[model samples]
Target chain A: RAHSNPFSDHQLEYPEKPADMDWSKLYPYYYDENTKEMTKKVTITDIGCGFGGLLIDLSPEFPNDLILGMEIRVQVTNYVEDRIIALRTNNVETKGYQNINVLRGNAMKFLPNFFEKGQLSKMFFCFPDPHFKQRKHKARIITNTLLSEYAYVLKEGGIIYTITDVEDLHIWMAKHLEEHPLFERLDETWESNDKCVQIMRHATEEGKKVERKKGDKFVACFKRLPTPEII
Target chain B: MSLIHPIQDIVSSEDGSLIFGIIKNEVVVFRVEEGKSQLVGKWVDELDRNEVIREKVEKEQARQIAENITKKRKTNDESAKTIESENKTAKIPTPGLGAPTVYSHLRNVTLSHGEKLLIICADSDKSVIIFDIDNDNKENVLQLKKRQPYPKRPNAIAISDDDKLIVIADKFGDVYTMSVDSDVKKIDGNVEPVLGHVSMLTSIVVVKDSENKKYIITADRDEHIKVTHYPQTYIVKHWLFGHNEFISSLSVPQWNKTNDLLLSAGGDRYLYLWNWGKNELLSKFNYEKLIDKYITDAHLASERFQNEENNLREYCVSKIVSLPSNRLVAFFVEATPLLIILKYSPEDNTLKLFQTMEFAFNIITMNVNNNQLLITLDNHESQNKDFIKILDFNENTDRFSTNESLSNNLDTTIASTLIEDKTSHIGSTGIYPLYTTINLKKHGESYS
Candidate 1:
């Protein structure tokens, strides 16, 4: 019997609309500092948030902004969810990261489906897959087509921070990002000094693993361009 | 002085002033004007140097600075300059450490309405990548515009008439259509499947009828040519049959403005003309005689293959195109050294052999505009020199005339090696990229 092809067979499940999603379930304290009520927004997103290392490190830094971690795999998502729960439970007095949460999501397929137009300010693609072979190059997350979708959900001047231990994947991400009309390469000063970049480089599970293994990590950051005027 | 890199694919600007070629890991643009060719774009994918080494070097620098402070050495300009140089070296990202290559097999580039040159390339990574080539700048730049990852490898792609949608046919027999512009959201926020075939789809073309109805014409390895309604793919209009072997190429000839016709060619030694909407097989031109002349000359006799029951003389049509001059151009791989052009009539649904270009190398790729046809031949004898022959289609004579002096030839050793390596390593590694695989392993780890 032939093995059934499983890569893209199943219909990816998603919320009918971004607004229909229950934001309270994910972030209990998603309230504006002045209002002290539900703010109902996710300003930051980490795609392929493996082990939630970056999310955990970033949660306290931006306590007011709601950050969402989207991981496709159930276990990885669960691990992140559990890690967040533990942190919140242990540090209840600190108001403990009620603005951050993890959800199981396939960013490549459902990025635009889950986010509204210009909903996000910062997007992170950390340690993306290095599809080494030429044919599998499309499977790499940073592509021209996907960047358009990313551009749609990101606000004007939104920042896309991409980090990878694999040099090939880093170049791939940078090349695609640079080519997109909606995005421009962030200058070196902006990239080197950004707090999120430092946290992303040192905090992610892959980043930490690469550090331990003595593997090289390459980082590239781009800012989503404001809409271009029609010629 | 011309690009030394092998040309993987080539496309001309609609105005025909510039020539774009996919060379190795980058796309090179050449301006052809005033009888001079100037290199305008050389967009190369540069791998970012590993940061671990830079961090280690910085750590060493810090240790040295601490030691200097402890030793109380005299502050000197030379030492300061040395430290500054080291910092600069650390800042400069090195290149060529990794493979620094893109496995681009089949590529199609088009100039969009916004003056952007869009190149849709079939990457070795089982995904489709769109590179936006901007020529407005003094130095042309090729940037990655969009990318769609797939489970199965994409074999062929077709852009819609409006250039808003791209339909991709994959090896797993599924076709998907995605919007070219991200601002234009899907009707329901989902990429709809346009069509599917039981076998590997080799080629696809989006055609429109007189009623302005869009249809997707797809050909597969199983000798099936299917015409399905665009967007509403549940309705398969027709399946044009009668091929003895695998269908390799499909083309929608638009010489006649009134009627919609599809030109299909396969492993068999015949080309089929079909009015897919009406489910009519208009004509089938048997090219056995034309092919036999070359076959007999090359000593590849039909009688030698009579005993072979499984592999009957396979004359695959690798590339087929419909010229605006009421002519059909096809390249038969097994036939060798011959390019056949057939006169097509929409009124009577008749096709006749108009002309044949003999002694030409086996045509690997054929691109035709109104007045010119660019043909890339498979130079098996010499792997390095892959020449793209420019043939001018004379309107008065109705014949394609080759210009030997004007043709562009480049050493495609890199492209040939990539092709050979691709075939050898097929299915050896995990088809998915590292991101998906790691996530898959994470799934397994979480489950158990």
Candidate 2:
């Protein structure tokens, strides 16, 4: 489906709080039963990661940090889940593809429910739903109110990466981040130096589709600023 | 059995001189002087569904009479008939959940702190109506002032500290702020929402920080509580993440001198206390032991879950009201007859169960007057005509006892006195969904 209502058709399960979340179920390699705790938490996230291309590509690049891809559609989430299982099964001897996983969730509504304050180091928005209608503008993934929530889960100096083929949506996403007080737009020099930005431009299934058509892919990045103290 | 409607909500003026009770679509007023009560004013919602239907019927009859008088003019009659029919079909129900239901009535009511303005949400037209309350004027106590309509029906409303800004959070997960005294903006254009949630917003309250900066604290049906900056609403604050189920109520107690302690509760068995300014869940106060018996069939989930292997039972924390000078906080569960009171321990910053009062019937709604509690009960089928109860906290005994004389006197007011009318029983689903909170529990399988 091209469009899914985030408000309805939602059967996602989340922890009461981040402390109660059982990350071992998602990343069994990191959980140690003797110590009864996971070695590390998920620090990188791919929001609306349609397919497992980005997760598969980032697994080897950042083997130490855990990466999670959150998708809302049922069939797409299932496809990503099966793809991860196959990748991990084929690389069992080397213990590869053990740091990446996919989960079904409406992240716009339940992001904070799964991640604690300042728990994430990076967030990605690659080829998200445009929701081009003026009336459906609030449904877009990037808004002033939702930016506040995204700021809550992201650590200070963390980076937010966005890429879209639709120029109008690119402008809309960039304008909202620029208007927010806690985020500053990263310049082209910083984007060129960043390795994740290079991997992101070609990893997603949507990016491949756009490349086949020889379409333009607009990219923008932002860095989260620290909260100011009250007088 | 004879049926009657119960009082759905209650509010009072700053002083204890006046009290208001909402029954169906009408707001009945009472004058509280000395220890006696007297009926003073009454205002019915103008946009009531039944009233609108009645007016349409009268208009159609008038049009028919006019057509009969002008039967010779076929062209004029045809044009007038077409216009009337068009008007009649204009209000056909929209096939969306956002559309107003048949049980359109006043849902939430409050009195502005500084100004004597009575603000209320009217569901019939998805508008907020404000009235100027003047006690000196004998002719009219509640005078009509302004009616501001929104794109969606408002679910919660909170006025800023300065009394200049009115924030309305609607059922469609959007929040809008408008000037308190401003008139008709609908003709100009639709006002965009300041911020929004993708879930049904249940309650909202405006609270200030240490430096006296105002922020809006909003909760939704998705078990989320969020705090956002006021003027720069786009600059999102951290979310208070704790509640396991839909959060139906949020209250920042006045006793918290610093104004940082926020109490929230919903379908969960525990009431959560949060230091909202710092984004910390302080503690969870369990009330299931006290309210376990109160959960009956009324607290069960919707009928769609009847065939499931296990029945899901839940209750919504309907109302939370704290006192002005004391540390006593009172709250009750929806469709339950128990009113559980808590005394905030300042030393530990925790809420301990102080006392529980069991009434003969379920409490419909309650409001704080000075330090007194004005409660209206669900008294539709019983022979007792006294539906209102007044209780005062006795400092010596550390318990709340009902005042017999005042309770009987208040019963004489219009809220308890019945006028003859033909409406369905209180048990009927026409006026209110008192127990709809249980439906907030998501029932379908994961990833459906």
List the TM values for chain B, per candidate: 0.69, 0.84
In order, what are the TM-scores of chain A for the candidates? 0.91, 0.98
Number of clashes in model 2? Answer: 1
Tens digits of per-residue lDDT, candidate 2, A1-231, equal 756787683677778777888999899999999999999999999998888899999999999999999998879989999999999999999999999999988999888878988899999999999987766877889987688789879999999999999999999999989988889999999999998888888989999999999999999999999976532
**B342-443 per-residue lDDT for model 1 (tens digits):** 887656778887888865455555666556676665444444455466677676886778755556322232333334333222233211121110111111
lDDT for each residue of candidate 2 in B38-92, tens digit (9 for 90 to 100): 8776677756565545654675666565665467356555565554444333243
Which parts of model 2 are misplaced by more than 4 Å? A1-3, A28-37, A92-95, A187-195, A229-231, B1-4, B48-101, B186-192, B307-312, B347-349, B415-431, B445-447
iRMS (Å) per candidate: 14.7, 3.0
User: Candidate 2 docking: what grade?
Assistant: acceptable
